[model samples]
Target: MTRVPAYFDAFLTAVAGGAEIDHVHLGHWDAPGAIGPARARAGFAQAQDRLSAALIAWLDLARGHLVLDVGCGFGGSLRTIRTCHPGVEVIGLNLDPRQLAVGFRRDRRRRNATWIAADACRLPFAGGMFDRLLCVEAAFHFASRRDFFAEAHRVLARDGVLVLSDIVLTRPPLPEEEVALLADGLEAAFGPWPDKWASLDAIGRDAEAAGFTLLVTDATANTEPSFHTIAPGRSDRPTSGDVLRELHRLGCLHYLYLRLDKR
Candidate 1:
């Protein structure tokens, strides 16, 4: 048997280890009562709500169009988009069969949505086939950010739009210790963080290189505190509980939302 790619292996491990992938793709882990302890459940729920809202706001999806959701985890974003844009056709692509299975089961009643197991670097669709492309929280996992952008450009119509929300390192951590701390926090939460997360400047550069015009970019740090506070209320435990406190202390979370138009 062939060995699995290291990044994929790490992704599976992180998901299995109770690191919720909700930020990247939406789907609740199906556990007996809940996936994580009560405290963790609260934090996870809060993050999910905020991330989901940001994705919808950024995409501003329209009806009667073809949309492709790359690295769609558990299909949460796809479902949300479809519900919001009733006449739209949504295709969710993911590499993990298990994740796709959960998404399929959850959204079985929605006929306008479809799911496929495929690589992000090489989507199995014709050029200019889609009107909109949305990727939430999963761009860092692509082996080549450049290739990912190129594929997005190729698959999108000339006037199409691409919305992406992902975790990005704001500035290079100065001290070596700070760098290590940041890296550790990310790895603990995300399995393995990407070597170079696209900064604001980098995002603009890449979009231009990929034949897209940058439209909007927003940092979500200020809003994060409010959402984190709200998340615990959805859980069975108190908001100040252990797991919530831990996730907060590590500064293990941050997000950026961007909108681009294909040229």
Candidate 2:
């Protein structure tokens, strides 16, 4: 069994209390309200799946290549990888077994698809276990981004690539007071925060320290559509969404994409 830390295991067990998670929107929704709720949800998921596919295309994969997707919530990207790259064996890893349990259809499990419930910072597999590592909008949740980067470096094959999307602070550094407001915005927009802003240079430094060389870096502010989504029951204070939008308008936040190769 994977030895989850005592406190974190307790926390995750309590959170799992026989339940599921997340409905707020966060992506480039070209058509926000053009359809019904069910259709819209399906479209958003498909878009995210396509985004995953786009990221994986950079790998130039070959037959029988092994891939690991960290924090593979609901296995959306897993489905895309299996369909898009035939003969590529892939693992969908998430910390919560409940997520892995419900991520697939009754007949969806395949010979090449393996799902593991384990922490990102402590991969349970052997060294040089994966050819490509994909993490989409999930790295920020790790207890330490630097720790996860080091873990990623350790598990990836010598020539392997790590492609991930994350939220980071905008350069030209905003006022120190803006940090709290941005945190509130993130809470309003995504309901998750690492309790501190991660700047672009900070991420690069962490990855460099992990024995990896940065290959590609890009930032996108294409989250305006997500801000328009309705997440209710916060009438008491300014919605975190509002704060997020204003800060975004001020160029204080960005959606970052990074591709790093193991040194």
Candidate 3:
């Protein structure tokens, strides 16, 4: 069976059960340079909040906007968005049912939030159904990000917006050995890697092919501090974070912020 998603879900479940797994995404630190995780728990939460705020800011949510969080993980962002825009309708779509279960078990007060088990590449929604789509640090596993882009294009309104933060190739092809190692690590942690990571330019082309116009792209260094992990697993153990840290250090991987408009 796939142990990767389970491992992550377990960590998040623990986070929901008062355990600290730091931040899931690379945080968007507002301060100057990277700060060590001296106060890891608080730092991680703060970083997560900052990144969520950054993503939410891009949505420009209104009272009636319908927003969907693809790969919604354990519903942290959903909770934050609901608080920020109480009048908006928020639904979360995830491939892992266990994650959704854990999310519901942890937070039972979401009167207006809905969670569904679904795949990102093949969204179970009608055309032009949502005004905004937000995906945070979870699209890398899609069998094909391009396909997800097309699906996002299909499900989003004509003037809809897509905001995504993900691990991407900042440079060309990973070394053969590194690719193998990284793939193995990711597969062990999440599931089989789809091997669909694309460069910034390639992603832009994919969006264009899917009938989207790029609105903004941010690759600031502020996200580096987010690498300071605090998951339930042993901090010293090599996990997906190790792979991300290595790829990022090698300048081959980046945490990218992209905002696209359906046209």
Highest-scoring model, lDDT: 3
lDDT of 1 by residue, 131-244 (tens): 989887787767766788899999998789888876555444357787576556555545434544456677678889999888664454433443333344545664322332
- Greater-TM-score candidate between 2 and 3: 3
lDDT of 3 by residue, 54-104 (tens): 998988898988999998877888888888898898898888777777677
Off by over 4 Å in 3: 1-6, 12-23, 32-34, 39-41, 170-175, 230-240
Q: In terms of TM-score, which candidate is strongest?
A: 3
List lDDT for all candidates, in order: 0.66, 0.68, 0.76
Residue 94 of model 1 has an lDDT of 83
Tens-digit lDDT track for model 2 on 70-108? 988767677777787878999989887766766644216
TM-score for all models, in order of appearance: 0.71, 0.75, 0.86
Cα deviation at 174, candidate 3, in Å, is: 7.5
Clash count for each candidate, listed in order shown: 1, 0, 5
> Can you give the lDDT of residue 182 in candidate 1?
53
Q: Candidate order by TM-score, highest to lowest?
A: 3, 2, 1
Worst 10 residues of 2 by lDDT: 2-11
